[model samples]
Target: APLMEIDPRSPVPKYAQLREILLDWIEESRLGVDDAVPSERELGLTYGLSRMTVRQTLDQLVDEGKLYRVPGKGTFVARPKIEMSLRLASFTEDMRARGFEPGSQDLARRVAPASGHLARVLGVAPGDPIHHLERLRTADGEPMAVERSNIPLALAPELDRHSLAGRSLYRLLEQEYNLLLDSGEQTIEAGLCDATDAKHLGLTAGSAVLLLQRRSYANGTCVELAISTYRADRYQLHSTLDARR
Candidate 1:
C-alpha cells in the first residue's frame, strides 16, 4: 500500500476525499479488479482517520458500484463499465471517433440465394443470388458486436474481395462501387446471446444483448440487410421521439 495523505484544509469532506483517492487508485490500475482492499480498521489506522470515516468512504464506493464487499472477506475493486453512445452513425465512424483501434474479423463470406424472409426484405425473388458477409467487430482490442450483412449480388459483386475488417461498409459501398446510401430503417430488440454469438462477442452464454435489424436503401432500391448484436451492459439505444401534429 502506498502512502495516502488527506488534506485537512481541503474543501471536500474527509470521507469524500478518501473515496476519491481510492477511486483514482482503481482507475490508475494500482488496484486491479477483484483485488482486495484494506479493511476499514487498517485503512483508518494507516490514514490516521476514524474507523467510521473509512467505513463511510468504503460504503459510498460500494453504493456507486465501484467496489464490492463480502461479509467475512473485504472490499474489492469492480470492473469498469464500457460506455456506448446512442446515435445515428456508422460503426466504423463511431469506433474511430472514440479513438478506439477498430478492426473486424471476417467470419464468412459467400454468394448464396436469398431465403423467403430475406427476399421479401430485399424486394427480390426467393432464391435470388445474394452476397452474405459475417464479421466480428472489435474496438480497442475488445469484442464489440457481431454484424451479418446481406447484399444483392448483382449490385456489389466485388464485395467479397474487399477487406472490411478495419473499415466502414458504408464507405466501401460508396467509394468502391459509387453506390449512394440514401436512407435506412432500423429496429431494435432485447434478447439473450446464443452459443456462437457469445463466443464471438466475448460474452457469457445467455447474457443479455441488443439485437438490431436494419434495411438500407440506395437510390430508391433496397440494397442491404444487416443484423447486429451488441453487448447490453456496454450499450444503450437512444432516439428522440416527436409527438404527432
Candidate 2:
C-alpha cells in the first residue's frame, strides 16, 4: 500500500510527518545511495514548513544513519548497513561466514605497558606487558572498521613474534597459542568519526560511526581488549529476541 499522505491538519507534528514521508521515499527507491536529498529550503517550501523544521528532521535521520552529510556536497541517501550478528566471532571468520573475503592492513604494532584502564580490563597488574595492535580491517577490499586491540602479553608470551598482517588474531591464538576463545562482552554506541578514523574509512571528519568496546575471554580469563570504530553508514548490529508469554 502507498504511504499515507502527510496530514497538515492532523495532531501529529509536521516535522514527523515529513520524516516518515522521506523515509518511505528511501524504502521505495525514490532515493538511493549517494542520491542527494532536496535542499532544506526546497523541502521547507514543498512541505510548507520553516527551514528550522526541515533541518531538524534531516539531522535526526543523519544521526540514525539513514542519511549522510558531506561538507560541501549536501546530504545524500546512505548505503545499506551490513548487519553484524551478536556472537563471539572474529572479524575474519565473520566475513568469511558471510561469503565476503576478509582482509586486514596492519597500521601499527608495538609492545606497551598495560596500565590504568587496560590493566583493569585485562585483569593484569599495572605495568604488565601489553601488545598494542592496530589494523584497518576490510571485506571485499572495502574498508569496514579500524580495530585497536590490546592484549596481555604475559598470558601469550612471544605474541609479537608472529606476523598478524592480514591474518586472524583469534586463529593465531587458537592454532599457535592453544588458547580457545570462550566468550566475549561488547557494547555499541553511535558516534562521529575523528580525523584519523575518517581518513581511514573514506569519510569526512564528524561522519557518523559505530563505536564498539569489547573484551574477549579465553577459558574464562581475560585475553583481549578491543576498541573498534565502524562506519555507521555501512555497518549495523543485529540481535534476535525471544518471544515471551
Candidate 3:
C-alpha cells in the first residue's frame, strides 16, 4: 500500500495514521535500512498534518527502534532487531542456535571479595572470596552484550586456570566443575548504556539498552550471579503465553 491514504474522518489521530503509513512503507520495502525518512515539513504536507504531529510520529518510531537520527542529517530506517527467546540457555548456545558464531573477549578475571549484595544473592558471607569475570560477548564478530559474572570462589577454586575467552562460562562450570545449573531466575529492564559499557558495545553513551540480572542455581544453591547489558537496538526479548479459563 505505497499509496495508502490516511482517512482524516475515520476518528483516528493524524499522527497515528501517519505512523502506521510509515510502518507499512518500511514493511513493504518502500523504505529500507539506512533509507532516509521524509522531512517533518514534507511529511506534514503529504499527510495533511501539522509539522508538530509529524515530528511526534517520528519520535515515537525512533523510540521504538524503527528509526535512527543522524546529527546534522535526517532520520533513517534502522536495522531489524534480533528476537531473543526467554529461556535457560548460555549466550554461546543461543547464538549457535540462531546460526551466528558466538565469541567473547575477556575484560577482567580475578578473585575478589564478595559484596554485601552479591554475597546475599549467592548465599555466601560478605568478604568471602568470589571469582569475578567480565567479558564482552560477540556474535559474528559484532559486539552484542557486556556481561559480568560472579561465582563463589570456593565453588570454583580452579576457575582461573582455564581460559574463558571464546567459551561459555556455563559449559565450563558444568563440564569441568560438575556444577550444572538446573534453574535460574532472571529479571530484565530498560536502561541507558553508560560510558564504560557503551565504549565496549560500539554505542554512544545514553543509548537504549536492556539490563538483565540473573541468578543461576545448581542443586538448589545459587552458583552464579550475572549482570548483562544488551543493546536495545539489536535485541528484543520474547516469551510464549498460555491462556486459562
Candidate 4:
C-alpha cells in the first residue's frame, strides 16, 4: 500500500503524521525489514508536503532506529530487535543460552595507552599501556552490538596473540589467561549512533542506540572496561525487581 496523504489543514504536525503512517505500515507488514523506504522527494510529492518536511520526518525515523541508510544507496528498514538479558555472563555464553549462535568480527586489536576514562575504570594510571580490542558482535550473522574493550597490558599480555574474531572473549580470558571474572558493574543509557557506529551497525547516522558501559573485576581488581552500543530496536534490557517482605 502507498503512504497515506497527510491532511494539510489538520493540527497534527506533518512530520509526525508521516511518522505515524510509516509506523502503521511497518506494524501491518506493508513494509518489512530491509524494505526500501520511499525517498524524501517521492514522499513529499505524494503527501503534498514540502521536501523539508519529508526530510525532517525521515530524519526522525532514522534517529529512532526505525530506518537505515547506506551511502550512495537508498534508505532501508532495520532488522527486528533481539532481546538481551541483564544477567552477568560472557557474550558468547549469553548468546548460547538464548539459543543464538554468537560470532564477532574483530575491527581492531592493538596495545595503546589507557585514556583518562579507561584509566579510572581499570584503576590504571593515565597513559599506562593497555590492550584495546574493538569488535562487531553478531548472532547468526546478524549484527548485534559494537564493543570496545580496554585491558591493562600487564594483566593480559598474551591477549594480542589470541584470535578474538568468532570467539568468546570471556572464555579466552578464563581458559587461556587463567583469569576468572568474579563480578562487574554496568551503566545503561540511550545514545545516538555516530557515522562510524552507524556504518558498523548498519544504521543511519544519528540512529538511537543503547549505550552500555561496564567494568569487570577479578579478585577485586578491575580487569577490563568495555563500552558497547546495541541497536535500540533489536535489544531491550529486562530485569525483575523484588521487594523485601
Cα-based RMSD of the predictions, in order? 6.9, 3.2, 2.0, 5.1
Instruction: For each candidate in the order shown, give its overall lDDT on alpha carbons.
Output: 0.85, 0.89, 0.93, 0.87
- TM for candidate 1 is 0.68
Model 1 global lDDT (CA atoms, 0 to 1): 0.85
Query: Can you write out model 3's per-residue Cα lDDT over 186-236, one digit (the tens) per residue?
Result: 999999999999999999999999999999999998899999999999999
Candidate 4: tens digits of C-alpha lDDT, residues 10-101: 89999999989988888998889999998888888778889899889888988677897887788888875666777668889988888899
2 versus 3: better TM-score goes to:
3
Alpha carbon deviation, residue 119, candidate 3 (Å): 1.9
User: Which candidate leads in TM-score?
Assistant: 3
- Comparing 1 with 4 on lDDT, the higher-scoring candidate is 4
Off by over 4 Å in 4: 1-80
lDDT of 3: 0.93
- lDDT (10s digit) by residue, model 1, range 8-58: 898989999899889878877889999999988888887778998998999
- Give every collision pair in model 2: none
Q: Given candidate 1, what's the lDDT at residue 137? A: 88
| Structural similarity to truth (TM-score) of each candidate | 0.68, 0.79, 0.90, 0.70
For model 1, where is the 10-residue window of minimal lDDT? Answer: 80-89
